[model samples]
Target: MTAVKIIKVLGTSEESWEDAAQAAVEEASQTVDDIHGVEVEDWTANVEGGAITSYKATVEIAFPVHESSGDA
Candidate 1:
């Protein structure tokens, strides 16, 4: 049997939405492990004065659940 878990993360990039997604995954690697995959949940772009400014994306980060043996 395998355990699984889901988490939500927001990634922002000045270049493109793809970069933002990659950034989120890269940053998440510092705390998360056993990454399964990322799914794009919601996405939106920032615009001002009728001009595109930036991209914002919301993604779901899925991974296997792990139990820690650390004591509190």
Candidate 2:
């Protein structure tokens, strides 16, 4: 049996939604470990002058929790 945890994150990019999503995961990886997967919960974009200026993505990242073993 394994334990898993989920955390929500927001990422923004001027490129595309995919880049936003990927950015979230990449940023999370910097501090998090054992990352399993990611689920995009929502997406939004910033519009300026009738043009999209940035993309935002809300994602849920899943990872495994480390269990402690008695060693002392």
Candidate 3:
């Protein structure tokens, strides 16, 4: 049997929304393993002086759940 866990996280980048999403996955991978996929929930940006300053991305990260085996 196999199971997966989904987690929501926000990533920000000064470049683009795609970069932001990639950043989220990269950061999550540091702590979590077996990263299967990612879903982009939303995208937003901050504007200053009529220019896009930063891009933000809301993403759901998916990874497999590992079960521990015990010896009896």
Candidate 1: the clashing residue pairs are none
lDDT of 3 by residue, 2-65 (tens): 8999999899999999999999998898999999999999999999999999999999999999
lDDT of 2 at 58: 99
Task: Give the TM-score ranking, best first.
Answer: 2, 3, 1
RMSD of 1: 1.8
**TM-score winner between candidates 2 and 3:** 2
Quick one: best TM-score, which candidate? Answer: 2
Scored by Cα lDDT, where does model 1 land?
Answer: 0.84
Superposition error at 9 for model 2 (Å): 0.7
lDDT of 1 by residue, 1-72 (tens): 778888888888878888888878888888998899999888778888997688777889899877777887
Backbone clashes in model 2, listed as residue pairs: none
Q: Which of the numbered candidates is closest to the native, going by highest lDDT?
A: 2
Q: Which stretches of model 2 miss by more than 4 angstroms?
A: 70-72
Write the residue-wise lDDT of candidate 2 on 1-72 in tens digits. Answer: 999999999999999999999999999999999899999999999999999999999999999998878777
Measured against the true structure, the TM-scores of the candidates, in listed sequence, are 0.84, 0.92, 0.91
After TM-score superposition, what is the CA distance of residue 60 in candidate 1 from its true location, in Å? Answer: 0.5
**Which sections of candidate 1 miss by over 4 Å?**
68-72
Candidate 3: count the clashes: 0
